[model samples]
Each structure stands twice: as structure tokens, then as C-alpha cells.
Target chain A: MNAGRPTGTRLHWWWVVGAAVVLVAAIIAGVMIGAVRLSPSQVVGSMLDRLPFVDLDTGLTVRQEAIVWQIRMPRVILAVVVGSMLSAAGAAYQGVFRNPLADPYLLGAGAGAGLGATLAIAYGPNTGDWLVDPIPLAAFAGALIGVSFAYLLGYTVRSGRTSVTLILAGVAVAAFLTALQTFIQQRESETLREVYGWILGSLNTAGWAEVRLVAPYVVVGLGVVFAGRRLLDVLSVGDTDASTLGVRPGRIRLVIVIFATLGTAAVVAVTGLIGFVGIIVPHTVRLLTSASYRVIVPLSILLGGAFLVLADIIARTAVAPAEIPIGVVTAIFGAPFFAMILRTSKAVVS
Target chain B: MSTVRFEKVSVDYGAGPVVSDVSLGAIAGEWLAIVGPNGAGKSSLLRTAVAAVEFTGSVMVDGRLTTTLTDKERARLVAYVSQRPRYPQGMAVFDYVLLGRTPYMGTLASESTHDIALVWEALSALRLEAFASRDVATLSGGETQRVSLARVIAQRAAILVLDEATASLDVSAQHEVLEVIDALRSSHNITVVSAIHDLTAAAQFCNSVAIMDRGLLVNHGAPVDVLTESVLQEVFDPSIRVLEVNGDPVIVSLRSEEAYQ
Candidate 1:
């Protein structure tokens, strides 16, 4: 699925290493050449000086260090975390749901975050303290609440916690949240531009505080997901067959849904709703490399992180100071990429 | 001996009871085929053995209640091949068969060297080693079914269960798969319980046949005894015929379109 024809075989280790290099290069590029262009040698040398027993120097001042570490590093790291998380979550969701179209936000992450962010924009106090910011906190709470309700509804439905039921429940909850978000946007048209920016998504607000806020959830969620990767492969074989193989499909789904949504919701809380990384990256990895989740999940993480960070570089640089929403950048790239995959891969449905 | 037994097992999937109080057993190393018309609950009955469906009563493999066993323990005892095997898109055939080691792996663990070796052995056993590196989706129906069997063989489960394992294949492929299964059963001394749609194939390979009619097991005996005219006419259409070939009973595999004809 490496975003094209899927008539392929095993994912090579070299490709994974290549993806890692891409991520590292993207990070290096993203850190340098921003609004205030900084020297790469000085930045890299200063970072190497901090390493234990290894020393290096290329003459850096305190001001540049602040710009690199405080502003750029956190922002790039956030992009890596958010990007890798979304892609991994998306791949996990697709495997659990067995639908290539499934994504990290398939179960209420986007809509819930939208409604919360909208509410904060329209009526919340303009607190200077980013620590207690109502916007991200509200978004986080809203996302968790929305997914919980979806799970509950799907579980209680006549047939019970089938993937279809969970998906339908997600759709319903998302619809309701999106409707509420729209109403808020309409009633407070004065803040429509602010709301629109948040909806379109950007990493402009990324800082150490935002990173700290999302780190725990993302870490725990991704750990659970990575651990369950093999189970996901088993679950892809359908519930009955997976059960016959001694996999508890229902339990595994619940665990994955809870954790993957947690990670997606955490990132959405901070980054707003960036799209395409979730849907495009995983399938692309699957097609290009291997269908095995063992390969897909890990590769999706690296490539997804690299892809978004590079997209972020383009986003901030393309228009020169008038930054396009990072979501817009991803969509510009992801839409055509998605189409190519659809055209070339007959195995998407299989 | 490791065996499978269902003691008064009944399955009800909300609409109604699909299988009702089925009491049956398969001895170790024996192939017991469940034969019935569509809707006679063969699938549902098989589902209980794998714990794929909710059911009342007991399904015991190797004298232990399947419900009481851990997932790993149950997996070690029984392996199943579905009627419609999900050929996960773009998955290498070797990787697909490696999934059979799920029970042996830690939750977060990748397959070990031993696991890889077993997969190779399974692939060779099924005559599928050549296709190991190929995508599972590229295989023909017969080859895909063999891949499925190889996965189960790698599982090392003492009991093997299949549902219409060869229904999708041509005659040659059907025998090709059945022969491998027969070889597995005889060589490994594995217990096999399969719901077979092909009556002749069922009669040819199975040690005994259990005939189901509307969720009840009405007859259970050797193929020669159970494939008689009286049983065939009662369970299937009256036009259904059975004949002897080289001392082996073969169902005609068809019903006369018109009773007059």
C-alpha cells in the first residue's frame, strides 16, 4: 500500500531504516530554515555538546538556542508525535475494522475536539496560562466523552459490539458533535475565523506545555497499540476465525479502540484536527512494503512522522510568513495520494 | 487421547436456535464429517466447538471444557479453518501461516526462530513452500485453502475443525486438499471434525458421518451405514441417490431435477 499498487510482498528492514532517516532529515530541516533561519552546524553541534562524554561546538549564542530548543524543537517533536500517532492509530483502526477507509478519527475524535475547541473560542475565558487553557482541556475531555458514548451505544445496540455497530455509533456521535460545533460557529460568527483556523488545524501553538499535556496519553496508547500489533493481524481474519484461533476479538477491539482513540484524541486536543496522515500513511505502508501488521504499524509510524514534519516545513515556508494550515498541506498531498492508491489497489476490498 | 466432545450443546443466535442439544464425539485420529442440507446447523454446531458462538451446555476438547481453558490452552488443543478463509490483502503466504503460532507467542512478541521453522514445515507439509513468499491474495481458491490448512497445521493443535473446506474448489483441487488433510490426520494422529457439503467427499474420507436435520443430529454411523437410501431420502430430497464404487459408497452428488425423470 505504500500509497500505490498493492501487489507487493514483505516489508524490508532497510525501508524502515530509510523512513527513520527521512524522519531525522525532516526533523533537521524542520528545525533549521524556519522564519528565523539558523545555522545547522551550530544547532547540531550545540545539541551534541549536551550529550554525555561527547563534546562539540560551532559557536552558538543563547538567543539562537532559545529559538531552536524552545520554539522549533518542541514544534517539530510535536509534529513527530502527532504524525506517528495518527498514522499508527489509523492503521490499527483499519486492521480492527478491516476497512482501508477507517482512520484515527473514525470514532468521534475530530468532531468532539471540534465542538470543544469551538466552545472555548466562542465563550471561554482568555486565560494567559497555557497550562490551564480551557481549549485543549475541553477538547480532550470532549473527545474522551464522545468515544465513551459511542462505545456504550454500540455495545447496547440490539446485535451488540460488532465493528459495524461501533462504527455506526461513532458516525452518530460525530454527527451530533459536528452539529453542535456548527451551531456554535454560526451563533458566534465574530469568532468564525478563529474557529476556522482551529478546524483547519495548525501546529502554530505547539510548545513544551502542549507536548507535556499529550505525552502521557500518546505514550501509553501507542504502547498498548504496538503491543497488540500481532493481535491486530489475527483480528483481521474476521471475528469468528480469530476467535477460533483463541483471540478475543471483542476484548481486543475494545482495548485498541480505547488506546488508539486516546492517542488520536490527545493529539487532536493539542493540534486541532489534522487529516490524511491517519488514512493515507498506513495503507501506503501496507501497499509499498508488506501487508503484515508487523511491518505496516511500525513503518506507518516512521513514514507518517516524516511525512507530516516535511509537510509542516512546506506549510510554514510555502507562502513565506503567511502560514497555511498544516491540515491544508496534508490534504493537498493526501488527496491525490489517496486516489492513486484507490486506482492501483484492487486488494483494498479484499 | 486428545478428542472433541459436545455434550448437549445448543446454540441460539437470537433469531432462534440454530443448533439444539447436539451430543457428539470424535475419537483421536478419526475424521468425523458433519453432513446436512443447508440450514441444518452444521456450521453452528462447529462454531460451538471453537467457541465462536454463544451456546448452552458444554464443548470439551481432550476432556477439558473449552470455556474453562485459557485462550492459549484452547488454541493448543484445537485449530479451525473457516469456510471462507480471509486472505489478508498483500500478506505473504509465509507470514499468514506464521499466524498459526499466535498461541505460542507472548502478546507483544514477534515470531521466534522456532516459530519460523514450524511455518516452513507447515508450508512444506501442505506442498505450499513455493508460494510462501507470495502474497496470499494471489493464490487460487485451492491454494488459498491449503494455505489456511498449513496455518492450522503449524498451530500444532491436536484437534482440527473445518467447515466446507473444499466447497469452493474444482474436483482436482478438492482431492488435492483432502489428500493433504487425510495425510495430516493419519500421520499426526490429529482429530478432525469437519462440516462437509460434498457428500461423496464426506463419505470417502470421513471415518463416520453425522447427519443433521433442522438443528438435530438424526443419524451417526459409518459412511456405508449412514449413506444408505433410507437416510439419504429422509434427510435430503427423495430423488437423492447413493451407489457403491469399489466397495466405497458415493452419493450421486445431485438430485434428479424431476422425480418423473
Candidate 2:
């Protein structure tokens, strides 16, 4: 047992540690390199002084402090949280299905969230009241709707026997949701730009309220996944094999699907469906490490958070005066890197 | 401690019957070899007992109808080890074998210290300790057979059903696997049921044999009686010569008309 622990296990831990370090650096870079440039030391000092009972002697103007503490910090933290949730959910989906191609978006979370945001923006009172964050609320509802349709259609066809039929059902549901969201956008000339910009994905208006609202759901979903890590390992073998091990593969799969959807929904609600982070980060982590759920689960979480933070930094600093859509930056980097990984790694697709 | 019985069981897979009116029983500590030609429903019979395939008539494990118990309960009593398992690449040998313990684990239950220890012991016993961290896809045919056997053994099941498990191995590897099966049957008192094509090897290991032809069980008896020349000719459709060397029956196929000329 001890002998078995050395070879692949050490490499997984190293990768996780490396990903964590990079995430911290990315967060710092994200805060330091925004439009009104602040040094890393100043950002750090400002943050430390803001914390209760930790008075570091760093004098700063109100504008610098607000930009660093209120704007960039919450936004960066939100990006990390959302990224970690989506990637970890993707890992859970892949592990449950035993298919490397599985992602949270494939299940209708993104589409549902899109519809939710559109309805809130197009129909809600135009006063911009703090109480009505339509996008996140709509996203949460849309995610639930999407997953329900996916599950309903999937179960209707095969009774939850194979992953193939389920994934296909997800594809159909995603297409349907996308079509609905497009129709809604096309009909409303007033809400078209708002819908388009939100769909492009952003962390611009993220605040403590958004962070607090989405964090609990994502954390709970992740907790459920972590607690069921061993079960996911059994699932990686396939349903029949998992059943022989004393797990009801269908029931366990349903649980995972629901939890993963919940996590993805939480993030999509706040950030309006950031794509590629879920698909790329988990696959990259799996390649760097073996397919053990124990290792992959936590590593995907940390690496995913780091990847999003780094991407957010690039989004803010790439064009000096104007910030690019975080989603655009993520896709540009994630697509090429994902292709390279796919070309090189022997990823098993069933 | 209870025996398994298949009474007038017939399995059909959207076609006509694959296994027709098959009645067989495996008592505790008995090694029963189901011998037959290819496509003769040998695999179907084993799968029916494991409740993997639908079948008419009764299939009982531990005196209870297999259909009555949950899938998990049936698995605990009778474990099926498929031939040439299709595995995702990069799966370590230890993890693959550890799946056998799934029947004993709860859905949310963590793999306890005991489960890990059992997996280690199984690996050592199969002499796969050295290859624990190696990818299962990289294993040779013989090594794969041993690893699968180790998994079944880890299942700690009362009844074991193997479907041409050693068919991919070399001659010596075949004997080694049979030897391991013999040890498992004798030591653990597991009711061993295997579908073997090699008549001589089947005769050497099994106390009882059931011959299957075209989805029908043609004959079943002790090895000496069921393995006679007439039965061999009818089932195998070959004029085989049987010789007794050191009181053990060894079957040799006679040359065909073209080869003989």
C-alpha cells in the first residue's frame, strides 16, 4: 500500500501545489495591473489594513483604496470562486460519466442561466434596484430548468443506463435552450445589447453581495462532491463495475449530476456562463495527474480558480484603457491549450 | 454455504433462445466446468445465473431466486468476471482490482482502512504487487487474467462464474490459471463454474462437466462419462482420439480428410 502511494500520488500533490501558487500570483496580478495601476506591495498593504485589527501603516487615497479593495478584490475573488465551482463541477460530471468530454455547460446550466438573466433584464423594473440582480437570479432558475430538461429527456430514452444517451440528451436540451434565449434576444431590441454583453461574460460589477449569494451554493456542491470522491472513483470504471462494488450507479450518478449542476448554476447565475474553464482545466489537471478521483477533484478546484484568476488579469491588462470580456480572454487561451492537450494526451473518450 | 441452481432456464437475446432449458446446480466446494463449442450459449448460462441477462425459468443463488434479491445482493453471492474487460487506458492495476470491493462498500461510504488492506493482500496473492501502479492496458494477456482473478477473489463471493477467462493465455499460463482456480475452489469452497473449450484441461480440473451444443445442453456427468468419444464427436463435430496418460484423459483431434491425404 505504501509502495503504491509513491509513484503517481506525489506527482498529483506537486501539480496541486504548483496550481495553488500560480493562483495566488494570478490574484495578485489581477489586483495590481488594472486601469489605475497599483503596485503589488500597495495592494497587499491596503488589503491588510482593511482587515479588522490588522493596521499596517500604509497611507492611501480613497480612490486607490476603493479601486483595490471594493472593485478589483471582489471581482477577482468572484472570478476565482466561479472558476473553481465550474471546473470542479466539470470534474464531477466527467468522473460520474466516465467520459472525458463531459462539461457542466453541456447539461443546460449555461442556457438556463442565460434565460434567467434575459427575463430579469428585459421584464424587470428598469430602476437598477440592488434587490433585483436579474442576471444571477435568472441564471439560477435557468440552470435548474436546463438540468431538469436534460435529465427528463435522458431518463425518458434509456432509463439512466448509459452515458451516451444522457450526453446526447444534454446536447439536445442545450440546443433548445440556446434557441429560446436567441429568440428572446431577437424579439427585444431594447434588451439585445444587455443580453449580448452578459452572454459574452463579465466580472465588472461583481461585489460582496454577489460573492455571498453564489459562494454558499458552490461550496455546498463541492462539499458533497468531496465527500463522495471514492464513489466517483468507482463510477470511473463504469456502471456495471460500480454496481458490483455495492454502489447503485444510477442513484449515485443522479446525485452527482444534481450537485454538479447546482455548483455550475451558482457560478452561471452571478457571472453569466463563463465557458472553456470547465472543459479545459479539469482535462489538463487529469493529464498532469492520473485519473484518480481523490487527486483530480481537489486539483481541478485549485487549478480552475488559478486559471480563471490569471485569465481575469489578462482581460484587465491586455488592452490598457479598456477591459476585455473575461470570457473572450478565457476562450482564446483555453481553446488552443485544450487542443494541444487533446492532441498529446491519451484521453479516453467513450 | 448454500448451493446455486438453474432450473429449466432459457435465455434469449432478441433472437431465438441462446441457452435453452438448461438445468444445472453447483453445490458448495464443487468445481463444475461447462464445456462446449463456440456460440453454444455457455456464456449466456453464466450470465443468467449472475442476473446480467434476462432468462425464463428460475435461477437461484443461496436458495433465493436471483431476480428477487437486489442487484447488489445477487452480486455478493455470485460475482461474474467477464472475458477481456474493456478498460479505460491509464487505469492502475491496484485500482482496477480494488473495484471488486465495491459490493462491500456503501455508496457514500469511504473506502475504509480494511478495504485498502484487502486490496493490497489480493494484489500480493496474485503476484501483481510489483505491477500495482502500472497501467492495466499495458498488462500482458496472462497478467490481465491473474489480475481479474484477483478481483473475483477479492469479491469474496460464495459463487464464481468465469466466461473463458483463461482463453487468451498461453498453454502454461492456462495451466497456472486452472491451478489457481483449483486452489480457490478447494480452499475457499467457492462453487466454481467456468466455460472451458480445452477438453483436456477441463477434464484435468473439473470433477463434473456439462457439454453444450447449439444453445442446448447435450450431456452432463462426471468427466469420464460426459467426455466419451461419442459425446465428443456429437458436440465438437470432430473425430477426436482420446488417450489415458497416467490415469488422466487427454483428447487429441484426428486429422481432417484434406490433412490426412
Candidate 3:
């Protein structure tokens, strides 16, 4: 019954190229196949025209240009950042906890971010002011605070301060924060539309401002996670064994959690809680490829970007002028795809 | 040319000490088996060598105190096998064995060619060349034990600690596993400290024995000198006997009914 590509000798070189191609293809599809369609040459010439020292007029109207650059490009880039962070964070969580089912939000960061966004919307002095959008910043702070509280509670209640206790602490923290958020959301009935839209999650309102806000965190966080790939692999053997191998298990877990939560909070501030991408993309990579974090982590970054862009395509197009929440779209498309992978690809996942 | 010495060693899991005031030593190039009934703290005592568990008192490796050694430095001296080592799902046998090279690798760098070469050497030594690419989850229990040993071999540690590593294997597989370990032990002049429940196997395979009871070290010496019928009866409640087979003393416990007679 054990049938899979020997995960040890991962088909490393070829899949790196393969994921690149998939990303390129997914990016192309994301750019080209939107509602107000532009021809391939027009899109290419427009992109080329924007580059310095390469000014050529591929006749495009101001409106189409706005549609391409202002609307589509920012959404796609945000998708890339959010998707990459969630997937990589998910991989790190699973490795540190040594549990395959672990997800990025296992530490209550997402719920904390959700509460932060709600508070900014409900209680901030200028709810109507778009010039200084406090939601993203507040959400980032709340996420870190939330995880800190969970870590503290886990440390206090746990006799040994094990990984499982941390997960349980996250669950307890998430429930409390979500309840508090719901209470506030209900009281602030005036901004219900904004609150609902934010909670449901959407990239339709994405702009260069939102992308600019989260880009640096995404870049730095992913870099730290990449550097920690081998250590994460060692951690898969569990914390005690990892310490025996000379790396401090507690320190590594803290560093990874801190950096990953930073990136995840940044994205959640803008995108809300885009659920399934964090948990599913890494798992899909594992089932199709290898259990080694070396393979899974990098692939998660690539494929997560691709998967979200594809899901966004459906989210925007499925019912024209009535946008579906990006979070819901991820599950609708991802769940069945994951099931198919589980059935057809008999890789030893656990 | 190394010796592992434990002095006034005591391990407590907050409730009480599992291994209390146990002074033990294993000379270089020797196999020392720790034996006792369940809850005798044999595993806890063995775990002290690898620093896997927290313990009071001092453990010294080749005259260097354990507390003074860094984690990687201690790893280079000791390799440990659990009662049941986990084979991560879908991990190839080669990858699991390659984990042994973690101590030698820098944080950012992957395995070097030399690290890979040692993995191959260890695999071939254990006759696991063909299984290198196979999924570790697919291996039989005996093969899994051997794979763990191969990983330890790749580590190239001077001291080996096994906590009933072959407890789940069949009778023939147990003997085979012990023989392979002994062969590697003598060839490389490695020191071994194992906790085994099988008294006969411990007597037959180990150069010396240490008997523990209720977290205390009760006896320590050569197997023949320490495993006498009278000595064992004092520790074990049941009727026990020492039999002579090819001049080796083998310990066995009789049934309750036979004990009364």
C-alpha cells in the first residue's frame, strides 16, 4: 500500500523548473483572461512601454490601461504575497508541531488579525477616512498580540510546555478573539457592509497601496523561512530529537513562528482570512511530491501563488458584477482538487 | 579510547526520580547492558548518555563532563535509538539516515558530498543498499531497527545508546540485530550502553551488566558475576534460575505454579 516517489531522493531539479513554468503560466492566465479582455500583443506592448528607455506606443486607451495596471496587476501581486506567506507558514507550523494537519492559523494569528480589523473599523476615529487606512496596521499589531497571549497561556497551563499545548492555547485564544470581534461587529451596525466585506475577504479592492504595505514583510519573512528549510526538516523528527541534532528546538520554533506570523498578519490585514490556501497548498505539494520540507516549502511558495491567482480568476468571473469572497472561492476550488490528489496520488502524507 | 561515567545520576520527571543516585560506567570498546523489571529506570539511565532527558549529577565522556560539552559536541560522542523510532511518512531510507549528518552541516548549507558518502558507507555496511531509495514506512520492523542502527553508524559517534531498540523484533531478528551491532561495535571500538528487558540476551551479548531496581543501581559487574540465580532472586520476585549452556550463564524465570513447587 505504500506507493510514492521516494521522498528522500526528491526529484529536486526538474520540479523547480516545473513549478516555475506553472507560475509563469498561471500569471499569464491571471493577466490575460479577465472580464475586460485585452489582446496578448496589447498587454505585452503596454508592459514593455512602461519600462524605462523602451517607450513605444501600442495604442491603448486610458480606461484599458487602468483596467490592466490599476485593477488586475495589484490584485495578482497581492495574491502572490498572501498566497506565498500562508503556504510557507503552513509548512513551518506542520514541521514544528510534527503534525501533518497543522495550519498557519494554528497559533491564533488569523483570528487576532480579524479582531484587529474589526476594532479599527468599529472604534477608530475616522472610519470613513481612506487616506489613512488603519485596518492593516492595527490588524498586524493584533496578530502579534494574539499569538503572544496564546504563547503565554500555553506556557503557564502546560506542565511541560509542549507543542500540543500551544495548539490548544491557540484554539482557546482564537475562540475568545472571534467572539469579541463578533460582538463588536454587531454593535457597529452602521459599518456592517464594510465589516462583512472585510470579514468575507476580497482582493477586488486591492491597490498598489495595499501591495506596497505588505511587500517588504512578505519578502523578508519568506527569506527567513527559506533559510530555515533544513532546520525544519530536522524538526520533522520532533522537538526532542531535533535538540539532539544540535539545533535548539524551542528557539527555532519561536523564530519561525514570529516571522511567519508577521508575514501572515500583514496579508490578513489586507485580504482578511483567506483560509484554505494556508493549509491546502502545502499539503497538495506534499501529496504530489515529497514530505521533505526542503521540497515542500519552496514548492508551496510557487504553487500557492499559482493556486490563488487561479482561484481569484473564478472569484472575479463566476458571477460578473457580484464578486465572490476570495476565501470561499479557495475552498470551493481547493477541496475537490485536494481530494483528487489524495485519491490518485497515494503518497504517504502521515 | 573513551569512557562514559555517570556519578550520582538522578532523573526526575517532577513527580519523583526515575533513576536515582546511579553511579555507572562503561569502558571504551565494551557493551554494557542495563537490566531490571519494568519501571527499573534502565531507559532513563541510558538516556542520560545522550542527554535526551534532564538529570542531576554528572555524566562524563572520555573525561569531559556532559554539562561542559555543547550539543553538537555531545552528539559527536553519542548516538541514541529510542524504544520505537519514528520513520516519518514517505521519507526515503536514505533521507532518514542522512539526518545523522545534521550535526556536521551548517544551518544554511545542505549536505556535502562527504556527508552523502558516509550515508552510503553506513547503508552498505548494514546491507541496506537496495533499501536506500525505498520508503522507510514500507520496511519491516526488523529492517526499521537496522535502519536506525545505520543512521547511528553514519553519525560515527564513539558512544551508542539503545533503549530496547529491538524490543519489537522477532526472536531471530533480535539475534541478528544484536550480532550486527556487536560486529560494528568491535570493528570500530565503539562503547555501547543498552537497556534490554531480555536478561538472557543481555548476558549473552554484553561484556558487563548493571541491574537496577526502583531507580537505584543494585548491582554492576561482568554478566557471570552479577547474574547469579541467588542475586537475581533478590531483585525479581518470581522463581528464577541460572542455567549453563555452552558455559554461558542464562537467566530464566519460572511460572508461579512451578515457583511454589
Candidate 4:
């Protein structure tokens, strides 16, 4: 393991090119191979003619047009956003903890969002603002609370300020909060079903409003983490080294934890707790690319977004007329894919 | 200029005191070596002096109290190189050495060409020019020690603290490293405080030796005066024949009482 250069390295630029190609192929597959198999030529011609820059018609508008634009486009966009957010958050969390096992879920972001969304479902619909979209707002609030609680708990302890301690505390908090949510759900039948469904995670109901709500938080959170990439590098060395290297590990960790949790919370608040995109996607990308934050951060974002869009396509078309929980589909596919990656790839210190 | 003075310093690592009421001073360009047996608190004293470990009492460096100064300022004045640092796998040897310059770098500023050049110079001084591009993880024990030395050299700090820095290396590598350190002291006038395990190496290299036993300073004097048969017997529980070679002391440990006494 002690080598001058990292072992079995993959060139980062190559991965970017490959990811771009895969993304394009996935998009085409997503559009053309739905319940109704549209011809590839027609699909391409229609896409080109309908382009805002070049207005040429490939024929057929009404029903076909609505299906492509309103139905398919929004879902695709949501998938991309959720995917990118999870992947970026995963990468950030892993960097901060300096452990490969750390993902968005490890720090209570997922459970907290679930708890937040559950509370909102229990209380929000009665507030008389159908325009307000309680699920996203309440889930956002829950996510913020969960993340802040984890940070506060970790920060408060003097000797237990390690990333390991933070994760353990988060797990405890998640368990307690999940139990409380369940107890609250038991009190009402209608809300119990909502809670059950929310915990399982779904992206079907996500719309433009949900998308708009998460966009700003995601952008700001990503920006904050990106700015602190250097600090993350210092942190990879132990705390003592980080201090000697002119970085205040305590403050840097606090900021990173906040930004990462916020992004995870925002995405989970809107789309529930989608798994694997955060944990699996970043690892796959890292295996293909360099561990350099300058490359990994942006690549994970793009690749994650693309992965989610592709996954969403599978979710929608796999069982037409009725959709499976997006979480189930991601877990089902991600488990084997992740295992394969592990089997083929050299061990990364998790 | 680094003027390190510890006044009645005491270091306690939880259970009890490891170093108690120890007072010492090392001026700029002075090299002071602390030589002692195992569990003598030599490492603790050095760590406490650099403020890497907590200690009670006053430590003054360049006229400012160590406790009062920020970590960054303290790091600028003193650089500590621990024996056999556990480097991250795949970290380049050059990059590991360049970490010495971390205190000088800005939060966002990438390692500049000047920093890299200095790192290279440090590597070259240690005769590790060919290993610059190699990973630190792949290095042998001797090579790793030299890499750690290069980092401290690149640090270019006024005061250098090494905790048994050459213990892990072979005799030849030890001499090679000590020679480089000797050159640094003469040319740059950098003050060095090292905890050396080999008594002969200490006697040959260090101008002044501070011997410790059971967390207390036993003797502080020139190696010729401090290193004696009775002192060795009392401290080490073994009798050694002290020989005078060209007016310098050479310690020869007796295999048994009949062999020399």
C-alpha cells in the first residue's frame, strides 16, 4: 500500500468523457424506449426541430408532445437534481470524515429528512396553503433540524469530537427520531400511510415547485463545500497535523458538516431519502477518476445527476400504470452494482 | 531567532506527571540533545516544548509565551518531526515533505513553485533526489526517516525538535542523516533538540547532553563529563568501560563483570 504514486490509478479526464457519453446514451434510451416505443429517427428529428434555436417540425404535437415535455422532462430534471445532490453530498461527507464508509445517511441527514417530512405530512396539509407544498417545506425543516442536532451533539462533546463519534451519535439520534416519528404516525391512520410511503422514498410526486425549492439550497451548499476543499485535504491528515498545517479542524469540520447536511436535507426533504446515489455513485466515479476534490466534486455532480435521470427512466417504465418506490429501484440496482465495483476494484480505505 | 526557555515546566498525561518541574533553555543556533533510556520522558519533554502536547508552566519562544501564541505562530518558530510518521498511503514523498511549509501557505494558495523548489532542495540535501516522485508509503524505514528529515529541513524553522528521529535507520543512514543535520546547524545556525537512543551517537554529535531517568533530569553537561562508568551503571543497570579516543569519550559496554572490570 505504501507506494510513491497511488495504486491502480484511473485518469480523471477519461472518466469524464466516458460519463458524458453514457449520459447521452441514457437520455436517448429514456426518451425512446418507454411504454410506447418511439422510433429513434423520429425522436431525434422531433428533438432537433422543437429546439428553441432551430424550429423545424418532425410532425406530431398534441399527446406525444405533452408526454415528452410535461411528463418526462420534469421527472428527468428532478432525477438529475436529486442524483447530483446525493453524489456531491456523499463525496463531501467522505472527504470530511476521511473514511470511505461515510455517506449522506451516516450523519443523520436521511433519517432527519424523513422525520421532518413525516412531521410535515402530519401537520402541513391542514395549514390551508395547497400552494405551500408542505412535504418539501416540512422535510426541509426536518433535515435542517436533524443535521444541526448532529453537529451540536458532536460539537458539545469534548473528547468525542471525532468523525467516528459524530457518526455514532447520528445513528443514535436517527434511531430515536425514527421511533418518535413512528409513534406519531400511529396516532393517525391517514398520516401513518403517508409516513410509511415517505420512509420508503418516492420521486413521482416531485414537480417544478419541489425542484425550485431545493435548487437554491443545493447551489449554496455545493458552493460552500467547494470553497473549503483545501481544508478537507488538510483534514485527511489527523487533527494534530491539520492544526500544524494552519487549518482549524474544529471550525472547518463544523462548516463542512453544516453545508453537507444542508444539501442532503434539502434533497431528501423534497424527494425522500434516495439511497446509493450518494454512496455508490461517488465511489464508482472515484474508482474511474482521481481522488482530487477539484476533479471529484464536479464530476460526481454531473455523473450523479445523469445516473438519477437514468434510474428514474427505469423506475417509470419497468412497471407501467403503477410506479415502484424510487428508493426500492435504486437499492435493488445499486446493491449489485456496488458489489461488482467492490469485487473488481482495489480496496479503498473506508 | 528562537530562544526556547521552559520555566519549572510540568507535563501530565492523565494518570500522573511524566515530566515534572523541568527547566531548560536553548538559544538560537545551539544544539541540545536529550539522551536517556526507555520511558525516561525524553519524547514527552520535546513534545511539550513544541506545544504539541499540553504542559503546565511557561515556555517562551522568541520572547513570546508558547501558550499565548496561536498554533500557526508557534509552528512557524518551531518544527517537530516525529519518528516514523504514519503517512497516508499513496502520498508522494515530495508532497509529504512540502507539508513542512504548510504554516507559511495561505488557506487557498496551492503549493507554489518556490515551495516546490525548496522541497526539492531539502530532498537533495538528504540525498533523496531520485525518490522525490516516489510514494512515501513505499519507502523503507531508513528512507522514511530521511523523508521526515527533509520535511523539517524544508520547514526552515528556527528551532527543530526530533524525537528519536534516527532510531529506525541503519548505522550508515544514521551517519548520513546526522551529517546533514550537522551541516544545517553550521550553515543555517538552526537550533536542534533531538532525543537520540544510541549513547555513542549522542556523545559524538551533540555538544551538550541532557540525561534523564524516571521523568527527572539526571545530568546536564558535556558528553565527556556526563558519560562515566559509575553513571552508566547507576542509570542503565549495566557497567560499561569508558575509553578516551583522541580526547573524545567512547563508551564500550562490558559483556560481563569479568570481561572488563
Best by TM-score: 3
lDDT of 2 by residue, A228-318 (tens): 7778777776665556555677788898889888888888877776888878888887776777777778888888888898888887778
The TM-score, computed over Cα atoms with residue i paired to residue i, of candidate 4 is: 0.84
lDDT of 1 by residue, A267-296 (tens): 998898999899889878776666778788
TM-score of chain B of each: 0.97, 0.96, 0.97, 0.93
lDDT of 3 by residue, B161-223 (tens): 899988999999999999999999998899999999888999899999999999999999999
lDDT of 1 by residue, B15-125 (tens): 888899899999999999999999999998998888877899999899999989998889888999888988877777887888898888877777777777788788889
RMSD of each: 3.6, 3.6, 2.9, 4.6
Give the candidate number with the greatest DockQ. 3
lDDT of model 1 at position B25: 95
| Tens digit per residue, CA lDDT, model 3, A1-350 | 21342325654788999988887677767777777887878877887898999998878899988988988888887888888889999998888888778887778887888889889988887855667678877888888889998888987983877888988999999999989988998999898888888877888778998899889988888988888988987887777667766678878888988898888888888888888887899999988888888898999999888888898989988997778999999999899988888899988578
What is the clash count for each candidate, in the order shown?
8, 8, 0, 5
Candidate 4, CAPRI quality class derived from DockQ: acceptable
Q: Give each model's whole-structure lDDT.
A: 0.87, 0.81, 0.86, 0.76
Stretches of candidate 1 off by over 4 Å are A1-12, A129-131, A337-350, B253-261
The local lDDT score (0 to 100) that residue B237 gets in candidate 4 is: 66
The ten-residue window of minimal lDDT in model 3 chain A covers: A1-10
Worst 10 residues of 2 chain A by lDDT: A3-12
